[model samples]
Target: MVQRLLLAGMLSGLIVALFAFSYARVYAEPNIERAIALEEGGDHHHEEAEQGTVSRDTQRNAGLLTGLVAYCAALGGLLAIGLAFLHGRLSVRPRSAVWTLTVAGYVSLVLVPQLKYPANPPGVGSAETIGTRTEMYFIMLLASAISMAVSLWISHRMARRAGAAPSIAAGLAVFTALASLLMTMMPAISETPYDFPRALLFEFRFHAALLQLVVWGGLGVLFGQAAEYMEQSGLRVEGTARRGIPNA
Candidate 1:
């Protein structure tokens, strides 16, 4: 289990970085990088960079990269390792933890700033100008939503079958999906009274991303417990089925 978890973590990391590299190459780069002065260069000018849809191939590959590397690292290190200390099982919660980190982490970095406080030059309409670039955003948009939905849904089902406390799992899933959508709406949320968590742990938009990865440390524990239960059930089911089979 230790070794498998380790392998999973490494593979997941490799994939995630590669995905980010590709994403940086495709999505994260061109749109925002164009107007560096307005964005990274510390000018709050809003420029609307135009974009289009992200094909399924790009989306799927990104998803796989995200799901595997980014996820396993946090989950394996935090959840899995922690579980061995407490209740040991390869539950699905760690999967959720991973989903949250990778998804939230990247969005906080890429989408949040651009969407809410994008740097726009005078000509927001210009292709390179800063405005609402629906085309590019949606590429990650469609892929992440679908990825979260499928993984969360599968976890929900597994949680139910395992008779585990799935409310947290279910809530996590729904919250995750909503958060993803909300992610694209960070600017709007930032404006509203609801605001956001103010504590450095949850607040401070600049470090919003750092906070995401950091908290996964605790989220890892929860995931580990869930993972333990999942492993138990899978083993149990396998044992029962084996016993039920006739002798060869």
Candidate 2:
């Protein structure tokens, strides 16, 4: 089980890393160049001077690829642990677990706080306020995660009495109301320049959300398949042992 999980995690990480590298190269890198141009007062010489010894190729390829792969690998390992723990606890089969984990990943990690505090491109925000903004974002993230967990618990408890459909509706209502209220209550951070292109900003955010979806969705599918295979293999070995079969 452990070996299967680790292998799945590595493969998922590799896939996510490749996807991110491509997306960053095409979508993110151009915005970064534009931001640097803006920061350099649109002076080509100044932009060239400000760039340190680190080559653009190295930054785009080696740095980005290494960091992304490492980060995704860590995320995959954590996800594997989560899937293992959730096994049998959620009364879900391997396939259903994939759906559950994918939804939870998007809701808890991306959707909730993203609506409240969307991702920004380079040179969009105040450096002085970065600490405060980060703190606020994390607080909102924790709140969102807790709200989802509590809502699910409430739904499970209510299911015993009110039944599954009613309980799900009630839980979803609670989640929606609470999440909306929290979003309203949370402090807003608006740092985009007044003249910044709205279309570009929209594109950046769209790609960012898509990136999260790819990683989480990929992890769920690959990990679930590997786990199911492991389970099936274990059952086969157990059955063979029960039949007093000799090794081939």
Candidate 3:
């Protein structure tokens, strides 16, 4: 059963990857191209820069596709494992639980950290600080995930005594407090050039966030449906076995 869930997750990830890739290709790629042009100062220079390395065409097409597929697929697998662990634990239905986890995961893992350090286009940041920037982002991500877990645990504990509404409120309160503290403790990172176009920058960031939304939202819905189907099928099988009608 666990293995089946994992397979479903990976498949769902792949399906979402296609949607994500299509969105990026249509909406995000142009912004990236513009950023590259801005960084290189013109098309001529950009072409020269790309002579020995991978071409932008390849990067935007096959490269982008491959990256999204691998990323979403892995995320799907993790989602399955999470669903399995949370199964029979949450009081809500399976679909609700999956979606709730998805929302929480996105808020903690992506949205909060992004507020502190939004993703810059390819040519925006310095090469020297790339390592430092990555490390900081991961630190923020980890802190947010941990805080969310703690908050959920608190909510679960409270739910038994206080009921759902109060428990949820308490969870939200704790999460906000923890998230605020963590954001404050982390050093700020702003690498965008002053000359960079504000409109373009905002557009790129918006698309990036939207792309993530598509991935997580798609996974949540798709996997939730898959889980429901699996559950119903299992029940049917169990019923058949009980009736000694499995010969068919």
Judging by TM-score against the true structure, name the best candidate.
Answer: 3
Q: Write the per-residue lDDT of candidate 3 for residues 96-128, one digit (tens) a residue.
A: 877887899999999999999998997888999
How far is 221's C-alpha from truth in model 3 (Å)? 1.0
- Candidate 3: segments with Cα more than 4 A from true spot: none
Candidates sorted by lDDT, best first: 3, 2, 1
Residue range 9-106, candidate 1, lDDT tens digits: 44444444553445434443333334343333344432222225554345446654565356535544543443343333334344554554445434
Clash tally for model 1: 24
Ten-residue stretch with the least lDDT total in model 3:
89-98
Worst 10 residues of 2 by lDDT: 38-47
**Number of clashing residue pairs, candidate 3:** 0
In candidate 1, position 245 carries an lDDT of 66
Evaluate model 2: give its TM-score: 0.88
The per-prediction CA RMSD against the true structure, in angstroms, equals 14.9, 2.3, 1.1
Over 57-157, each residue of candidate 2 has an lDDT whose tens digit, in order, gives 67768988898888778777777777777766776576577667668767976899999999987768899999999999999999988888888889889
Question: Cα lDDT of all candidates, in order?
Answer: 0.45, 0.79, 0.93
lDDT of 1 at 173: 67
Worst 10 residues of 1 by lDDT: 189-198
